[model samples]
Target: MASSVLPTPLLKDELDIVIPTIRNLDFLEMWRPFFQPYHLIIIQDGDPSKKINVPEGFDYELYNRNDINRILGPKASCISFKDSACRCFGFMVSKKKYIYTIDDDCFVAKDPSGKEINALQQHIKNLLSPSTPYFFNTLYDPYAEGADFVRGYPFSLREGAPTAVSHGLWLNIPDYDAPTQLVKPMERNTRYVDAVLTIPKGTLFPMCGMNLAFDRELIGPAMYFGLMGDGQPIGRYDDMWAGWCTKVICDHLGLGVKTGLPYIWHSKASNPFVNLKKEYKGIFWQEDLIPFFQAVSLPKDCTTVQKCYIELSKQFKEKFGKVDDYFNKLGDAMVTWIEAWDELNPSAAAALPNGPAK
Candidate 1:
């Protein structure tokens, strides 16, 4: 990985941003501003021949399922289940020390005018220094107090509390916690932020792939384990799993994990109304919750990603009752299967083929 310093003068060469996209050409075009000065690796999982409109002077690389399957492995098989293959492509090709992964539907917000580039330059210096590897996650909601959703640090910092940035606040919803506070956004000049919370040494938390950055070295070998057979990719909670894996590796090595600082605006692509309708109609139930439950049952030494699965499972069960009681139960069952697999095969759990340990 090349040493990347934060850019001065707002030129494009300072950072490398990796985006995994499918057919959202307009969204891709809209995000062109964030792709400046950085190498863009667009993983087009569907048609290898499909043309994408890329910005001028941007160095871009395109990859298809065949390429992905070779890099990943059995996990790639999960991509076949989704229309757009999988979301694992971005991590597969990220070669920079500081990699920013954003969704196709989201774009980076531009820094406010009148702020000197020195602020951004200084921010970059802080980011590059060996302080703590901070992961930035965003909360997006138009109805929440202050700015839609909260970003950067958690709402209330309690020990062992799940340090997750809310994706959106579900207002007036019973049985769900409301996100009521907002942290001051880090200098908007940069896309990433240093987190405020802290964890034990070598610990890793599940990072939202939508927009997050950390030293490439800390990510370790879990990327290869996320692959699928047909070269597609896994979907749903893979990012959390990746985070768990990173945590396990770090914990084994005694690295501390922290959260807080720097928040970004995540533009929602799917219609909020339509999604709400689905949720109301029980169409969008979280089926993955089951597998997550099962994942937690694995050995105590299970990967960090597996632990996250368990944590999510507990959250789902505690929040939404039994899966059978709900409209969807398959999601829960899938997580259960993962737990069983890990328990039955401890060796497989310890090391993955093509994963980082090798």
Candidate 2:
């Protein structure tokens, strides 16, 4: 077992890790060695009949759905059955400077130097590095061939101006669109890549739920993964939609999306058949949704990104009224989430140059 691999001592107190899982806690023991300095929040997703058993002396909280609902209140119901939605629960309760969402099956990849490197530490280093105005960049993978952009990266922004959102990529089992799996899936032990990309300004890329982290300061607006996956009406696309919403709002706020670096080895592989089924609706809807999001017109008075997000959802409902009832609930949930976040982080809300519209 290795100790903390944080590049800076300060990160010890600044980062918290969240893992949402339907599986038991046995796999978590592997993480105990490096987690001493950070807090871990384990969200038990399904069949919470048995309690998750965390190793003794670990600073952690194991919460089942009921516990999360209690913390999130009535609006929690809006989140529904999506596992990705659990991230909102983690984000709201996170007390650190940064919050990391790592799937239970994901692990930090070791560097060529044979030293264990923590992905969260690497990402923070990249994120905090002095950049002009704002950061919207992709971390490039050193091991990958050619110019392989992260899937769902917005082509429109490839040449657009620079702007403060960053998204990382995964190795081993890559997180690609379902169509990529039609041929074959990556082997469990596929070689991973390294390197961080500071995506050029004006780039809009989707954020991955697994192995992703963001600053708590932006929590009020970007900390949402809506109703799209984990057995909800839609089988997949929860994080993708959230990413799109985040990018849309980020663009309005002059923020950039950075990808690459802090890579993780995805131990679990999606069954291609299951993935194809899960992604069918999402793949079909995303083409139209992107342009729709681009065309959405926020109110002139819309100040905060959260307000813009609510407006975006409302617009989505109007245009796609017959899409699905859950879509409307997603809008309702975002409204509820923004209100709850404002109440909880009044200081952060006040600090926002454009506070939520009253």
Worst 10 residues of 1 by lDDT: 169-178
Residue-level lDDT of model 2, residues 1-358, one tens digit each, is 8876746444777777787877765655665656656788877776657666766766877777787677668766655454556666777676676777778787767766767666666666655653322323343531233544456656664443332444666667877766887665653444545555554434446668887766666533666777656556666576777777876666565554556666677777777788787778777787887878767666756667666777887788877767777667777777777777776666666775543332
| Highest TM-score scorer | 2
Question: How many clashing residue pairs, candidate 2?
Answer: 22
TM-score of each: 0.49, 0.80
Report, for every candidate in turn, its global Cα lDDT versus the true structure. 0.41, 0.65
Clashes of 1: 36
Off by over 4 Å in 1: 1-15, 24-34, 69-85, 110-127, 131-195, 199-206, 223-235, 256-258, 269-358
lDDT of 1 at 53: 69
